[model samples]
Target: MRYVKLPKENIYEFLGRLKEYGTLYAPVKISEKFYDFREVDDVKKVEFHYNRTIMPPKKFFFLPREKLFEFSISKAEYKETIENVEPFVLFGLHACDIFGLKILDTVYLDEFPDKYYKVRREKGIIIGISCMPDEYCFCNLRETDFADDGFDLFLHELPDGWLVRVGTPIGHRIVDKNIKLFEEVTTQDVCNFRDLEKKRAEAFKYHEDWGNLRYLLELEMEHPIWNEQSELCLACGNCNTTCPTCRCYEVQDIPSLDGDTGYRERRWDSCQLRSHGLVAGNHNFRPTKKDRFMNRYLCKNSYNEKLGMSFCVGCGRCTYFCPAGISFVENLRRIMGIEDKSCPSEISEEIPKRGFAYASDVRGEDI
Candidate 1:
């Protein structure tokens, strides 16, 4: 609820001051039309006005590949070895990613706690900025586009400068500790924030919503679109790897050739993989690519409903990264009988998958 003003001209000065609090990691431009979160000392390297990052902040917290423990080859002994992490601040996050972090928290910390992820959450601070949406984004329709919590500080972009909303004690300390870098918020500042919120909500290019989809998706289990879309699915798992909410990973234990010592590691896994549903003795439960593809939708739409959240969050990262050109929204629209721009004029006809026009605002494909 607290508001403060940051002049665009002095924004770098503000970023530089944050290093006084901890090591800083913000969105840095990797190339034209590509950005990623990286450690930075120079504030000028940060870029906020981006459509999206190649990956989300989960890369840092959850870790794509991490050592879970070490074990002896000779004995039945093992010890947990989660890494000890240091305090740091992640700046320039988009609101959807911030909410994405919240969904991660719900998965790891709520019922069966993940000690490693919980520790990372406690050690890190989240600072997000307002972002514009492309056709691939629908976080707005699911109401995950804007964040009120899950962030230490949320910045609203404006024509003049930035309006910041402080959300936690750590965020307050950042402002209070560097009082000289920020100025008092005026009445006009509040109006600007309001204007930006209204503008952001209306900015999303894809907003076809079909109400609570938990039951709708369950009833759609036998829908024919699943069979047709599976033809276009490559099952590469780019969707799960790039998605902020797809929390699936596989654990492995690697033993030394000499049989002296071994270590257990956990790496990110994708349900779309052929081995994802494979069991002992080589029996795969979800055998077909279509079964795997439909499972992703069911898990997002129905399984997480009782958690009081629509798991998709409508980030649209899945469709953007799919090599086979599967658009979740477009596919969902097909199942729900809603008209989609990507669909053919004949609803019964199969959708022609998109080309590798990944960067095109309208043409869709996954990263």
Candidate 2:
């Protein structure tokens, strides 16, 4: 990995150069405090210091509603609609959001890969940006506050410039193409970077040990918190919709008026919905609110051991969008019996910074 400097003055020029690769999409401030990823007409509109977007970049890959194929009623013929997938550049992604994308990759890019998702992943270029943890964020405890991989390029904010880390060949080529706009990282730059990293780590509101959360969750399957939360939950499905790692979707066949010709389409689904687990004979696997709610939480925490990571990146979207004021971290803390512990003013121990490590920090390397 190589670290370079992108002076603040050249941000527009750098963004302009990125347009050569694909259509640019970045965070744009829509309301007073809300931001969402939209097509970037002007690079100046990009929100460099956003907390979190309303929707995750997962929508780009696993579309909310997409037509799988068009079939003829007379003949058994189908045509895939993924041939027109175009390249796109998703910029200003936070560390947790990037990690969420990696989780999706493990599911869709592994065995039984979906061609639609595969095409989107192939055409998408991920450009991550460093962000400070908000009051709702708990990515620090989840170990996803800083992403070391799964992005083409990641930028760390600096006083007068941006510390750009190249993670892939495409990312390196981007820097090389606009080499004149960048400068070599200096000793002072490294110092400033470390200071920023420390500050960001200290900004997190939750710093408890999340290493054993999955185990605790497994043991507390019948805890009362699930019943309590289920009562408050409106079955709104906002949590699943906004979650970056939630990948539940339902497929349907839309028939024409003649019922002969039609197309198959899939749309996003939520576990909180009553019809999610409905099967033949009017039977629903997750019939009650508590069952559905607990399933969603368990799926995020204990499932997917093969991927070696929890489904939740601790992005806080689920909690943020919840209308009933249900907090995922708080619920987890309740399960772990650590609801009384407060965030310490000082970090208990040194926080290991992610991304490109300094030369001196690299073991077995001549400094």
Model 2 Cα lDDT, one tens digit per residue, 142-185: 78888999999999999998999999999999889889999999
For model 1, how does the per-residue alpha-carbon lDDT over 27-49 read when each residue is reduced to its tens digit?
88898767788899678888878
- The segments of candidate 1 whose C-alpha lies over 4 angstroms from its true place after superposition are 303-307, 340-367
Q: By TM-score, who's the top model here?
A: 2
TM-score of each: 0.89, 0.91
Candidate 1 Cα lDDT to native: 0.79
lDDT against the true structure, each candidate: 0.79, 0.86
Counting clashing residue pairs in each candidate, in order, gives: 5, 0
Off by over 4 Å in 2: 340-367
Residues forming the 10-long window of minimal summed lDDT in candidate 2: 354-363
